[model samples]
Target: MLADRIPIADALHGKALELVHEHRAASVPLLERHLSIGPDMAEALLLRIARETTVVRRVQSGLYVYTHGPIGEELAALHGFAQEVLVALASNSVDVDQLRDAAGRYGFSIPHQAAGNATVAVPLCLAQVVNV
Candidate 1:
Protein backbone atom coordinates (compact mmCIF):
# COMPACT_ATOMS: atom_id res chain seq x y z
CA MET A 1 0.00 0.00 0.00
CA LEU A 2 2.77 2.41 0.93
CA ALA A 3 4.64 1.46 -2.25
CA ASP A 4 1.59 2.40 -4.34
CA ARG A 5 1.43 5.91 -2.88
CA ILE A 6 5.05 6.95 -3.53
CA PRO A 7 7.42 6.10 -6.32
CA ILE A 8 10.04 3.56 -5.25
CA ALA A 9 12.89 5.92 -6.00
CA ASP A 10 11.30 8.68 -3.93
CA ALA A 11 10.23 6.34 -1.16
CA LEU A 12 13.73 5.02 -0.70
CA HIS A 13 15.61 8.26 -1.15
CA GLY A 14 13.07 10.73 0.23
CA LYS A 15 12.16 8.54 3.19
CA ALA A 16 15.80 8.30 4.18
CA LEU A 17 16.11 12.08 4.10
CA GLU A 18 12.95 12.40 6.20
CA LEU A 19 14.21 9.84 8.72
CA VAL A 20 17.56 11.52 9.16
CA HIS A 21 15.89 14.88 9.68
CA GLU A 22 13.57 13.37 12.25
CA HIS A 23 15.97 10.99 14.05
CA ARG A 24 19.37 12.55 13.28
CA ALA A 25 21.00 9.13 12.82
CA ALA A 26 19.63 5.64 12.72
CA SER A 27 20.98 2.12 12.44
CA VAL A 28 20.07 -0.46 9.80
CA PRO A 29 17.58 -2.33 11.99
CA LEU A 30 15.94 0.87 13.14
CA LEU A 31 15.58 2.13 9.60
CA GLU A 32 14.17 -1.19 8.46
CA ARG A 33 11.64 -1.20 11.28
CA HIS A 34 10.59 2.40 10.74
CA LEU A 35 10.38 2.12 6.96
CA SER A 36 9.12 -1.46 6.86
CA ILE A 37 11.98 -2.48 4.64
CA GLY A 38 13.46 -5.95 4.54
CA PRO A 39 16.77 -6.51 6.28
CA ASP A 40 18.33 -7.89 3.11
CA MET A 41 17.66 -4.68 1.16
CA ALA A 42 18.19 -2.20 3.99
CA GLU A 43 21.94 -1.66 3.67
CA ALA A 44 21.90 -1.16 -0.10
CA LEU A 45 18.88 1.15 0.12
CA LEU A 46 20.52 3.19 2.88
CA LEU A 47 23.68 3.59 0.86
CA ARG A 48 21.77 4.59 -2.26
CA ILE A 49 19.55 7.01 -0.33
CA ALA A 50 22.50 8.59 1.49
CA ARG A 51 24.26 9.19 -1.80
CA GLU A 52 21.45 11.45 -3.05
CA THR A 53 20.79 13.70 -0.01
CA THR A 54 23.08 16.14 1.75
CA VAL A 55 24.93 14.64 4.69
CA VAL A 56 24.59 16.96 7.65
CA ARG A 57 27.30 15.09 9.59
CA ARG A 58 28.15 11.78 11.09
CA VAL A 59 26.55 11.46 14.52
CA GLN A 60 28.26 8.16 15.29
CA SER A 61 30.79 5.76 13.82
CA GLY A 62 28.37 4.32 11.29
CA LEU A 63 25.43 6.72 11.34
CA TYR A 64 24.71 9.97 9.49
CA VAL A 65 21.95 12.52 8.98
CA TYR A 66 20.68 13.71 5.61
CA THR A 67 18.65 16.57 4.17
CA HIS A 68 17.78 18.02 0.78
CA GLY A 69 18.97 21.51 -0.13
CA PRO A 70 16.59 22.43 -2.96
CA ILE A 71 13.61 20.76 -1.36
CA GLY A 72 14.16 22.60 1.95
CA GLU A 73 14.34 26.00 0.30
CA GLU A 74 11.30 25.27 -1.84
CA LEU A 75 9.28 24.18 1.19
CA ALA A 76 10.18 27.34 3.08
CA ALA A 77 9.14 29.53 0.16
CA LEU A 78 5.89 27.61 -0.23
CA HIS A 79 5.11 27.95 3.47
CA GLY A 80 5.65 31.70 3.30
CA PHE A 81 3.38 31.95 0.26
CA ALA A 82 0.66 29.88 1.94
CA GLN A 83 0.83 31.95 5.11
CA GLU A 84 0.51 35.22 3.22
CA VAL A 85 -2.38 33.92 1.12
CA LEU A 86 -4.20 32.49 4.13
CA VAL A 87 -3.81 35.66 6.16
CA ALA A 88 -5.15 37.71 3.31
CA LEU A 89 -8.03 35.34 2.69
CA ALA A 90 -8.86 35.15 6.40
CA SER A 91 -9.32 38.92 6.72
CA ASN A 92 -11.94 38.95 3.97
CA SER A 93 -13.09 37.22 0.84
CA VAL A 94 -10.25 37.19 -1.65
CA ASP A 95 -10.91 39.38 -4.66
CA VAL A 96 -8.76 40.54 -7.54
CA ASP A 97 -7.87 43.83 -5.84
CA GLN A 98 -6.85 42.16 -2.58
CA LEU A 99 -4.75 39.47 -4.29
CA ARG A 100 -3.04 42.15 -6.34
CA ASP A 101 -2.30 44.01 -3.11
CA ALA A 102 -0.90 40.83 -1.61
CA ALA A 103 1.25 40.21 -4.66
CA GLY A 104 2.67 43.72 -4.43
CA ARG A 105 3.35 43.34 -0.72
CA TYR A 106 5.08 40.03 -1.37
CA GLY A 107 7.28 41.60 -4.03
CA PHE A 108 5.73 39.77 -6.96
CA SER A 109 3.07 40.45 -9.57
CA ILE A 110 0.12 38.08 -9.64
CA PRO A 111 -1.38 39.56 -12.77
CA HIS A 112 -3.78 36.64 -13.02
CA GLN A 113 -5.61 37.34 -9.77
CA ALA A 114 -8.90 36.34 -11.35
CA ALA A 115 -7.39 33.10 -12.61
CA GLY A 116 -5.81 32.43 -9.23
CA ASN A 117 -9.14 33.10 -7.54
CA ALA A 118 -10.80 30.57 -9.78
CA THR A 119 -8.03 28.05 -9.08
CA VAL A 120 -8.37 28.42 -5.30
CA ALA A 121 -12.15 28.67 -5.34
CA VAL A 122 -12.61 25.46 -7.31
CA PRO A 123 -10.86 23.40 -4.65
CA LEU A 124 -12.73 25.20 -1.87
CA CYS A 125 -16.03 24.62 -3.60
CA LEU A 126 -15.17 20.98 -4.20
CA ALA A 127 -14.26 20.49 -0.56
CA GLN A 128 -17.61 21.89 0.50
CA VAL A 129 -19.51 19.89 -2.07
CA VAL A 130 -17.77 16.63 -1.18
CA ASN A 131 -17.72 17.38 2.57
CA VAL A 132 -13.98 16.89 2.60
Candidate 2:
Protein backbone atom coordinates (compact mmCIF):
# COMPACT_ATOMS: atom_id res chain seq x y z
CA MET A 1 0.00 0.00 0.00
CA LEU A 2 1.10 3.57 -0.64
CA ALA A 3 1.98 5.60 2.40
CA ASP A 4 -0.19 8.52 3.45
CA ARG A 5 2.55 10.80 2.19
CA ILE A 6 0.76 14.12 2.83
CA PRO A 7 -2.16 15.29 4.89
CA ILE A 8 -5.34 15.95 2.92
CA ALA A 9 -7.87 17.99 4.83
CA ASP A 10 -10.97 15.85 5.41
CA ALA A 11 -13.34 18.50 4.11
CA LEU A 12 -11.87 18.34 0.63
CA HIS A 13 -10.67 14.78 0.19
CA GLY A 14 -14.03 13.29 -0.75
CA LYS A 15 -14.94 15.82 -3.38
CA ALA A 16 -11.41 15.94 -4.73
CA LEU A 17 -11.25 12.19 -5.09
CA GLU A 18 -14.72 12.21 -6.62
CA LEU A 19 -13.66 14.56 -9.34
CA VAL A 20 -10.52 12.62 -10.08
CA HIS A 21 -12.31 9.28 -10.26
CA GLU A 22 -15.32 10.52 -12.17
CA HIS A 23 -13.45 12.62 -14.68
CA ARG A 24 -10.30 10.52 -14.58
CA ALA A 25 -8.34 13.77 -14.38
CA ALA A 26 -8.15 17.06 -12.55
CA SER A 27 -6.94 20.64 -12.88
CA VAL A 28 -7.04 23.76 -10.72
CA PRO A 29 -9.91 25.39 -12.56
CA LEU A 30 -11.95 22.20 -12.59
CA LEU A 31 -11.81 21.93 -8.82
CA GLU A 32 -12.65 25.60 -8.42
CA ARG A 33 -15.69 25.24 -10.63
CA HIS A 34 -16.95 22.06 -9.09
CA LEU A 35 -16.10 22.70 -5.46
CA SER A 36 -16.72 26.48 -5.43
CA ILE A 37 -13.28 27.07 -3.99
CA GLY A 38 -10.71 29.72 -4.74
CA PRO A 39 -7.57 29.23 -6.80
CA ASP A 40 -5.33 28.71 -3.78
CA MET A 41 -7.46 25.96 -2.31
CA ALA A 42 -7.91 24.28 -5.66
CA GLU A 43 -4.17 24.27 -6.15
CA ALA A 44 -3.61 22.92 -2.67
CA LEU A 45 -6.05 20.07 -3.23
CA LEU A 46 -4.38 19.24 -6.52
CA LEU A 47 -0.96 19.21 -4.95
CA ARG A 48 -2.12 17.06 -2.04
CA ILE A 49 -3.80 14.55 -4.32
CA ALA A 50 -0.80 14.31 -6.59
CA ARG A 51 1.65 13.95 -3.77
CA GLU A 52 -0.28 11.82 -1.30
CA THR A 53 -2.05 9.13 -3.34
CA THR A 54 -1.27 6.74 -6.15
CA VAL A 55 -4.67 7.03 -7.83
CA VAL A 56 -3.57 10.17 -9.62
CA ARG A 57 -0.34 11.18 -11.27
CA ARG A 58 0.74 14.69 -12.19
CA VAL A 59 0.94 14.82 -15.94
CA GLN A 60 1.51 18.54 -16.42
CA SER A 61 2.01 21.74 -14.50
CA GLY A 62 -1.52 21.86 -13.05
CA LEU A 63 -3.15 18.72 -14.36
CA TYR A 64 -3.39 15.18 -12.98
CA VAL A 65 -4.62 11.98 -14.56
CA TYR A 66 -6.26 9.37 -12.43
CA THR A 67 -4.72 5.98 -12.87
CA HIS A 68 -7.98 4.09 -12.84
CA GLY A 69 -7.84 0.29 -12.38
CA PRO A 70 -7.45 -2.37 -9.73
CA ILE A 71 -4.42 -0.77 -8.11
CA GLY A 72 -6.12 2.58 -7.80
CA GLU A 73 -9.23 0.97 -6.41
CA GLU A 74 -7.20 -0.99 -3.90
CA LEU A 75 -5.40 2.09 -2.67
CA ALA A 76 -8.71 3.91 -2.31
CA ALA A 77 -10.02 1.05 -0.22
CA LEU A 78 -6.96 1.23 2.02
CA HIS A 79 -7.61 4.93 2.49
CA GLY A 80 -11.17 4.15 3.51
CA PHE A 81 -9.92 1.71 6.15
CA ALA A 82 -7.48 4.29 7.41
CA GLN A 83 -10.35 6.72 7.81
CA GLU A 84 -12.26 4.13 9.83
CA VAL A 85 -9.29 3.71 12.15
CA LEU A 86 -9.19 7.47 12.65
CA VAL A 87 -12.87 7.50 13.55
CA ALA A 88 -12.34 4.83 16.18
CA LEU A 89 -9.45 6.77 17.61
CA ALA A 90 -11.46 9.98 17.72
CA SER A 91 -14.53 8.42 19.32
CA ASN A 92 -12.58 6.66 22.07
CA SER A 93 -14.56 3.54 21.31
CA VAL A 94 -11.56 1.25 21.33
CA ASP A 95 -8.21 0.87 23.02
CA VAL A 96 -5.41 2.89 21.47
CA ASP A 97 -3.00 0.00 21.41
CA GLN A 98 -5.45 -2.19 19.54
CA LEU A 99 -6.20 0.52 17.01
CA ARG A 100 -2.50 1.16 16.55
CA ASP A 101 -1.80 -2.49 15.83
CA ALA A 102 -4.78 -2.65 13.46
CA ALA A 103 -3.67 0.48 11.63
CA GLY A 104 -0.16 -0.87 11.19
CA ARG A 105 -1.52 -4.03 9.62
CA TYR A 106 -2.99 -1.86 6.91
CA GLY A 107 0.25 0.07 6.44
CA PHE A 108 -0.93 3.12 8.33
CA SER A 109 1.95 4.13 10.55
CA ILE A 110 1.11 5.90 13.77
CA PRO A 111 3.97 8.09 14.91
CA HIS A 112 6.10 6.51 17.63
CA GLN A 113 5.52 9.42 19.97
CA ALA A 114 1.76 8.81 19.85
CA ALA A 115 2.10 5.62 21.87
CA GLY A 116 0.23 5.11 25.18
CA ASN A 117 -1.89 8.25 25.44
CA ALA A 118 -5.19 8.33 23.59
CA THR A 119 -5.75 12.07 24.02
CA VAL A 120 -2.52 13.03 22.29
CA ALA A 121 -2.40 10.07 19.97
CA VAL A 122 -5.86 10.61 18.51
CA PRO A 123 -5.08 14.12 17.38
CA LEU A 124 -1.67 13.15 16.10
CA CYS A 125 -3.20 10.36 14.03
CA LEU A 126 -6.10 12.51 12.88
CA ALA A 127 -3.70 15.22 11.75
CA GLN A 128 -3.20 13.13 8.64
CA VAL A 129 -6.84 13.52 7.61
CA VAL A 130 -7.62 16.95 8.97
CA ASN A 131 -5.85 20.09 10.09
CA VAL A 132 -5.05 20.04 13.81
Return the top candidate by lDDT.
Answer: 2
lDDT per residue (tens digit) for residues 3-81 in model 2: 2344457878778889878887777778889999877777778777777777786664646667678767666656665
Give, for candidate 1, the lowest lDDT window spanning 10 residues. 118-127
Give the per-residue lDDT digits (tens) of candidate 1, residues 40-122.
Answer: 45555565565454444334475644434654444444445556567756776545555445445544433345545422222
- Per-model TM-score, in order, reads 0.35, 0.43
| TM-score leader | 2
Question: TM-score of predicted model 2?
Answer: 0.43
